[model samples]
Target chain A: MKQENRQRLAGAAAGLVNGLFGGGGGTVLLPVLTRELEGRHAFAVCVAAMLPMCAVSAAAGMWNAPPDLWQAAPCLAGGLLGGILGGLTFGRVPVGLLRKAAGAFMVYGGVRYLL
Target chain B: MKEAILTFLCALVAGTLSAWGVGGGTLLLLALTLLLDVEQRQAQTLNLLFFLPAAGAALFFHRRNGELDTAAVRRTAIPGALAALVGAGAAMLLDVDLLRRPFGLFLLYAGGTLLFSRGKGFSNQRGEEAPPTKKTQ
Candidate 1:
């Protein structure tokens, strides 16, 4: 398959997952982008690509139920702050260990949900 | 009041992780539902919104650095949008309890994969997850 086709497929897969799950599309999109482009650009491109996709999905996800802005306020506050920190720290942080830790916790979290 | 603070703290941590590309949105969703007593679907929706500002902030730096590829975004975003509609509808229709199990299994799969995969940098351009034999086109 063409790389473009593969990328589009990745995009669709990512969109579906994020919309259904309410997040996680970037994970689906990243690996494909990494292969298609250089690592730095791939991450940036994936981020850019996800914005619009998430916008559409978020809008849909919120249709049946809207969050109270009061509840959303603090979370958004933290999220915005974290985003700035992470963005600045991007290549600077040693994410390999962090990713592992998060993955381990996610595994634990997943099991907890399961049982 | 306490819950608000807790939610902010959790979102802060999750946001950083996600901004670093570690899939922290999943963590925030779980934290909200299990730890803070938020509804699952609501948590999910919140997670989606949570990503926007975080990603937007990151995009600014990336764009300044000339790291973005507009052509690629064009290729991917359209199909992604259409598929998102299908996924979003299904998510809303399902009860949170029923949704929990499938979502759980997915989490397990993704987390396990992340845990087991070879360690690599966040940017990925540093040389990993690429084919040893294949060349970039």
Candidate 2:
């Protein structure tokens, strides 16, 4: 497939996931983007693309959310700091180790959810 | 107070992962739903909202490092945004359990792939193979 077409499909898929799941666009975007662009560029593209997608999805869901959702403000604040930290350390950290840790966490999450 | 602190810590990890472009939302969702005992739909809503700031911060860092691809961002953003609208609508109509099971399965698939995959797919700024791609399946 053409690069343009692949990108479109990937974008659409990522958007859909972001909308449905609230913010997992990167999970869908990473593989497709990796195949379409260079590795680092692909990661950048995923990050760039997710910002808008998350904004739109959050807006769409805002009216439906319960008031209790505000309780998450602390989490959101922490997440902001984490994002800054992650961004600053992006190239400095061992990508492989981070990936492994992320993978382990995902697995733990999955199993926890399943049972 | 303790719960608030825990929430902050979880969000911090999620935010970092989001900045790293590794799907922090998934982790956030898991923490909220499984650990904190939030409802699935509500957890998802918070995850989306939490993403805004996290993504913004990450974008700032990525741009500073010259990692962003302007052309690619332009091409993907609109289409992705539109599709996200459709997805959000669907999620609203779907049952809570229906969303939870698939999300769990997806996490498993994605996590397993990341753990075992060789570090040959992605390249760093130096153009050397850096690590495997971190996308969820």
Candidate 3:
């Protein structure tokens, strides 16, 4: 298949996932690209890719009632920090361990919310 | 040939994760590093770029529904943007493994805060009760 076709297919797939999941596709995409494409291209692709997914999820969350600005602001601030720090911290960190740690955090958060 | 198929599959899965509210960036980064052998920095950068449209769409939808606080978004935009730059700069300065430990700690802190902190809507404001949110008649 052509690259454009592949990308379009990928985008559509991403849109659907975003529609269903809310905000967690990059977790899945980056690895695939990294494994397949490898190197800087994979990294660039991952960043470029999440733009749409995050935009969609945020829009959906705010679709009916906008969240309190004060509340959202801090989170957004964190996100910005996450983006920059995440980018910079990359390569130097032991990502596998980081992944396990992050996963543990998520599990904890999820359990708390569920309970 | 294999790469093309894998990329498509990855995109599809990532999209689903994002839709569910898990924030695809982190997971994608994990996959890149563990499964694909992609470097961390490159993964992070790409993840951010991917988030653009997803975040934008969410913001637009919220705006249309009157959920977006334009003033608030505007207020934080400059500061947040600057912070992002600072974060990026900081990333460049530190050893990523070292940074990861602290970052992980921060996440734990944030999770703890969310789990333990009472709703700040009223308690933090002295003895005053929070104003009841009136439904727009």
Candidate 4:
């Protein structure tokens, strides 16, 4: 497929997934984009493109309902800590190891979902 | 090429799963590393970036449906966003390969848990087969 066509299709797919499921589509989308594009740039572009959609989906979830501030505080704090730590720690780690870990996680998650 | 199409298709699936609260980031990482031949760090970083917007949209949708706990957002997102920024910066500096092994392991564990726990009350929604509990009992 042409670049423009591929881009268009990808966008359409992202929108459809976001609209239907809220925010689950990108997990699948990223891999598809990487495989199809055959390059980090394409993968990066796909990730960049989905940013707006992700924001929109999250906003959709938060639009009407208000979380209990107290209850969420810890989670938010933890998420923040986790993000920072994960980001930083990941860098020091071996890429091969991470890939293996990812594969393992998928197997586990897939099994969990299926079973 | 075959590679390009495959990556695009994978992202498409990842996006859908993200909506249901299964973080698309991890899935993206898996796809990139296992299928697309992308570097593990690249995949991990990309996964983080991809998830931001999807997560944002889901939060918005939940808000519209009265599912978002605003108080939670204030406490969690505020901190989480800040941490994400720091994390992103750190991710920029680290060796891409270092994190791949554990990340893979994590996916394995999570996927396994989900599969094994099927038909259980662990999920937020109670299954039909679950026996009814009696307040009277």
Candidate 5:
């Protein structure tokens, strides 16, 4: 398959997983992005790519069963603050360590969800 | 107020990790269900919603840092978005509980790859790969 085609395919799969699973598209997109982009750039770029995917997923989820925004307000507020901090930290961190940490988080998620 | 405070803190942690381009939504879902006793589907929905502004904020910083790849975004966003609709449809059809184990396994596989892949180390957008930590030390 052509490279662009593979990327689009992965993008579709990433979106589907993000939509179906309600996030975690990064885990899927990162591997693909890393091949084309540089290290830290790959991680940052994954977020860029996943943005619209998450939006579509969020909208679809709401359509099926609208959530109370009131319930989400606090989480959003905190997330906004944290996003700023994490973004600031993104460029400074070592990619190798970041990679390992992401892996560890996935491992943790695996265990948490499995139980 | 107490419940709200707890929820905010949990999201703060998740959001921070997420902005780093990792698994913040997973953390948020886990915290909401395990710590706050939220129902699974609701937590999942909340997680999707939570990602938007958080992602926007992170994107701004990444753009400023010159870390974002606009070309890459342009290439992937549309397909990803369309597929998201399909994914959401799938989520709606299945029981939320059933997705957990599969999602869990997926995470483990991805994580293990990340942990051990020995892919290229971190580099700046200028294409300067950072020297190893030991070398720097």
Candidate 6:
């Protein structure tokens, strides 16, 4: 497949995941982009692309959300701080460790939902 | 108070994951749905909202480090954005329970891939030798 076609497909896939699930587009994009781009570069592109995708998806689906501002506020606040921290520590932490942690979290989430 | 604390902590974890350039929203969704007993639809909604700031922050850092490819961004953003709207509409129409089971299975699949694969996809932070590059025609 042509490079342009590949990028478009990756983008569409990323967008679909983002809009459908409300997030996780980057995870989907990372592998696809990695085939054409460098590892960090692929990640960067995924991150940048995700911003607009998330925004559009969120706006489209905002009406579906239950009115629960009080419940959401704390999580949002904590997430902001966590983002800042994660940004600050981005390349500082060991990638292996982070990957394991993320994997563990995903496994736990999947099992929890399954049961 | 306890609920508030848990919410904050979960969001923090979610944010950190987002910053790592993975899907922090999945973790956030899991936290909200399982830990907080939030309805599946509501948790998904909150995950989308939470994604914005976290992604913005992560992008800022990635940009500062000169990691983002502007040309690629331009090519992908519009198509991706349009598709996202369609996807969101589809999700809104789907039954919540139906969505949940498949979503869980997906998470498991994704997690298993992450755990077992030796793919160099997520090792961005390590200063190890870069993976062999493929020349794009």
- Looking at model 6, residue A81 earns an lDDT score of 85
DockQ score for model 1: 0.63
- List the DockQ of the predictions in order: 0.63, 0.59, 0.04, 0.05, 0.55, 0.64
Off by over 4 Å in 6: B119-121, B129-132, B135-137
Off by over 4 Å in 3: A1-115, B1-13, B16-20, B107-137
lDDT of 3 by residue, A57-108 (tens): 4444344224444333333443443444434333333333333444565545
lDDT of 6 at A12: 90
Tens digits of per-residue lDDT for model 2, A44-114: 77888888888888777777775363556886788789988988877555567667787898899888768
Q: For this target, which candidate reaches the highest TM-score against the unseen true structure?
A: 1
- TM-scores, all models, native as reference: 0.90, 0.89, 0.43, 0.46, 0.85, 0.90
The order by descending TM-score is 1, 6, 2, 5, 4, 3
Q: Sort by DockQ, best first: what order?
A: 6, 1, 2, 5, 4, 3
TM-score pick, better of 1 and 6: 1
TM-scores computed on chain B for all candidates: 0.83, 0.83, 0.62, 0.69, 0.78, 0.86
The segments of candidate 1 whose C-alpha lies over 4 angstroms from its true place after superposition are B120-137
Q: Candidate 1: lDDT over CA atoms?
A: 0.77
- lDDT of each candidate versus the true structure: 0.77, 0.76, 0.39, 0.41, 0.76, 0.75
Q: Which is superior by DockQ, 3 or 6?
A: 6
- Winner on DockQ between 1 and 4 is 1
How well does model 6 score by local distance difference test?
0.75
Tell me the lDDT of model 1 at B126: 47
Per-candidate fnat, comma-separated:
0.68, 0.71, 0.04, 0.06, 0.73, 0.66
**What pairs collide in candidate 1?**
A39-B125
Q: Chain A TM-score of each model, in the order shown? A: 0.90, 0.83, 0.71, 0.58, 0.80, 0.81
Query: How well does candidate 1 score on lDDT at residue A115?
Result: 92
